[model samples]
Target: MRMAQTPAAADGSSGDGALGRVPPQSIEAEACVLGSMILDAMAIDQVVQILHDDYFYRPAHQIIFRCLVQMRHESKAIDLVTIKEDLVRRDLLEKIGGQDYLVALAEGVPTSANAEYYAQIVRDKALLRQLISVGTQIVRDAYETQDEAPIVVDHAEQSIFEIAEQHIGDSVITLQDLLRHTFEMLEQHEGQLITGLASGYTQLDELTSGFQKGEMIVLAARPSMGKTSLLLNIAENMAVIDQAPVAIFSLEMSRNQLAERFLASHARFNLRQMRRGVITPETWTALQTAAGTLETAPIFIDDSASLTVIQLMARARRLKSLHDIQCVLVDYMQLMLYSGRATSRQEQITEISRGIKALAHDLEIPVIVAAQLNRGPADRPTHTPRMSDLRESGSIEQDADVVMLLHNEDYYHLGEEGYQPRGVTDLIVAKQRNGPTGSVPLVFLKDYTKFESATFGVEQPLGEPMADAPF
Candidate 1:
């Protein structure tokens, strides 16, 4: 006849298809049903998908399976009341303890009952759940082997409409899902379709949502052209206002110097007064408030004078995993060197660029690596830097998805009064791979070490060009 079912098989059958197999007598006492579904081995999403069109479950029957899924996902015991209410919502079982007491009771689920209830339900739905139990065993084995977070690799060349099929050879979604998923796919890629990540500049945000994640965005300028200030502005925009974590890798300046400069910019205090001493109450209050705001801001600063490429990658990974860093701000590129290998300056920089790009892709975050333009630009009459003018343009441009060269006319020419902007640095978006390449005029505050969006007569869409092409 049929093979004899073990006591554990009781985990798969309840009353020969009654309400979830009522919690078994105990973990030791299992049912003798021939085939039981363990469900313990499935992905939470897979479990949900498996039960999407369950012909047998009336909301109540869904509870036990759901409880099992939750337990596996959380690695914790399930709450009975929550499960009960979910059942009640489907008109499966009479509202446990009425709808009023339902929530409170759900909040107080005992572990033994939760585990047993889920297991017992599996017993009742044995035939329908065999795969789940098998999956559970597989998952247990995998988890035992890997202590780190599981890396899920999507080999599908096309990101859109990627279908997920179950073990039984049944596709869960159809043509409708494909269409909806296309729109949703675009929604997921919002940052990639736009430029700069900060939301502070309304127009800039409109032009480019922010810098795309997994990209190397260079912000380059000469010695005193508000490069650091522009950096602080972006940090403030992303980390402060938009609430995105931004990392700053400062090689040239100390932590204190960067802070002092940022404070001077927002506080509007003379750099000499703020630095040399003589702090007024208003200025002190402003400094204190700025400090307080920055205290909780997700702006990570590494003012390491001798930061190596490998060390930077290590730090960036640590930040991406722990601090949830979304964007990177490297003060200047030339200052960075490779620590792991020995090579010439060009080789070192080449390795550094490769490492930075890899870091961005690995972390799936935008990396803003600023750089220094060569003397070629300085030697030019107008002093506008070309892509070749970048200190190490070959490696930098090759690795970068977007290369931006910041140019401020006022910084180069001091004499012109009206055109000479005291508080503006125009950000030149010299190159863009995904869309049209053009200059975006961004205001640079020399004092605050920040960049702000300057609204113009017309707001051009991302693919269009602006009229004032200063760069």
Candidate 2:
């Protein structure tokens, strides 16, 4: 075993006490980690997994670790002599305390067995320093910012989250490492009917396998095409039947209006009649029962009239941490506000779309966002929406893992010749990043404002509205 040296200020006290208080650091641990890496070539791999070069508080240590990593990547042997030669070749040996300092580091650690532990100590201190720095910046922003309070608060939350995410370690992996987890996932799904959260539509679930985690699913349609209804129905299925917590952000509708729609759909009553004072005793009983069921369902709604993507993501992050929500649904993307820097409306939509996709990935949950199609569909003869018809920006289609365009033929050709009123709506899976694309038919009950699989033998509500219609 080598004798350990008494630790000294590796970089001569620059960052040690510059901020009034001593910054968090473990100089001895950093030295031990470096020494172990030099002592055993195998220790380099283990230590790199736990600590990056920037984790070292001393600039000299940072340079040395970075050189060691580069040498490893270049398939060079790592030892006290070779490290010193490489640093000299790079003209950094003198800056990092020269050949004597390298020898001291190599002889400072007893063994390479504790490299990981030393690396972890360095990492913990680095995280503490980062937290203090972020906290200081947040205080400065709070005390001297022209931005609104909400914007400042969002910035603070984002900075802390960035630090927390850094502690999650590296996400890159070799195919060999990935296949192990892939096989385990396959084993878990060996006999499963659905590998992801089911949409309660058999045909759609068969096509999608279910809405996958870390996916952005775009449900697009023109106005009055029942996209919101379908979004809510999927939310109901996930929250109520699948027993998964769901977060709904409705920028277009008020909470009371959404609640009324949910009640009408659940109770199988005419939405217009329910809205008016034409409810019967049976209707009241059914409404009460449906309300009771929804009251206990893990369906949380945020009907913020205006929300930027940053604010939306912050809320979703908080919801996931608090309730472990499995999915998020955002109603109609075009209505989303973007207060961030942007040159054009398309740019704003692009940022919002990208942000939503990032939110889904960061939270590891499926995010279903309702979006609008352009009038290109209306100008066409068959009125089918293409992927190009996604309104505002093409980024919506680019960021989405799956794009489903809702189309109801009856809405366009209700009283036309040779038109059949089956109340069938086609959910066109226009773009699917991982699966096959096709149209899944759903039966839309206009009276109840509900949607279900068309494969079922239930009578389709077609043609004219009921006598008490408010349309």
Candidate 3:
């Protein structure tokens, strides 16, 4: 009768035999584990780490196990007399069959040395029961939920992922353990130029030891400030040069447009001419060679124009598991959709920012997110972008590990008297949680839509543009 009510028995396809059989459990293993803990107080520590109260199948065993754990927490001895007294004080003595039951458990086990082994069996059985419950829930949700198919699938995947992560357990450690781990990491990074993935920019790499894992990096700028160009350059450097897998979620541009920019930037071809189908022979050959190299680079681009934060996280999780992607890029945050019940745009932005930060921490990878600034920079006397200028909400700045604001003075003085288009852009490191903040100058090659480290006082030549130049 008990077996018929078990979660595993709910599946009619499992046949009558499975429904009639008992749920996966071992009462003897539970008895042995409790007996071992009672016989030797020192053995309780090992058993507690593996088995919890719910791990015991029988109600009496569960109550006894929980009581023993409570006694251990109170620094009380685990002998029979103390166990009975504590149980009596809590009105649970008769409920768990009194002192005779405790004596029987202690006498049932041969030795306390096998406590861990007994605990493992109990844990395994508990895990099987959990799997049965999760599977039953998944089936129920599939048949009854009103959500779309993709949302349902995402929920199921997340549920299974949670179960898979159970083996990882808690990360708490003693100071001695922490010191040993730190020293090991230091030794592994000894004589290394950078401790994280290199961004391929000389000074930027120096300012940040390259983008560290599990960090949310925000790049903010006004419209047409070359934020997207700089993001692509960094992605190209990591994916093409370093052979690292990168996932790019572009809500603003199509994949074809992105590919064209990558080709022009990498091959040094004129983007305007390429768009006009007027590529010269030399440029054609260079583009072909660049395409051959880029064809093999592990860069995955998703040009979904309308992406919710939940969908983005689900796709990122898939890419990280399938391809071991080292980094992720979202081109501009204001365009992302939030399906949750947000009262205002600011609340929506806050949730989106937190979601991106959570993704970085969960995947243990650096996530570079492009953001748009407000009119604060343009209205100011200095025309400089600040962390406070981040649009929609303050949560973006709060959540980011690094905040880079792009400013090109040339944009403000395009046709002024004696004004020159020096192609110089200032990447202001306004907020860095772990390092000093400063501005790094870069040269933005408008012709190829590329950016590189700039030499001070050096001006890049700007040739005349084509009649139909997109810019």
- Judged by whole-model lDDT over C-alpha atoms, candidate 1 comes out at 0.59
Model 1 residue 250 distance off true place after TM-score fit, in angstroms? 0.8
Candidate structures ordered by lDDT, highest first: 2, 3, 1
Report the backbone clash tally of model 1. Answer: 29
TM-score of each: 0.58, 0.82, 0.81
Q: What's the TM for model 2? A: 0.82
Among these predictions, the greatest TM-score belongs to: 2
The residue-by-residue lDDT of candidate 2 on 268-313, one tens digit each, is 8899998887998988999999999989899999999899898998
Q: lDDT value for candidate 2?
A: 0.86
Expressed as tens digits, the lDDT of each residue in 360-465 for candidate 1 is 8877788988788877667888877667777754778777777777777666667765664534445566666664555566776444455667655344333443
**Candidate 2 all-Cα RMSD:** 6.6
On the 0 to 100 scale, the lDDT of residue 461 in model 1 is 33
Worst 10 residues of 3 by lDDT: 1-10
* Cα TM-score of candidate 3: 0.81
The alpha-carbon lDDT assigned to residue 52 of candidate 2 equals 85
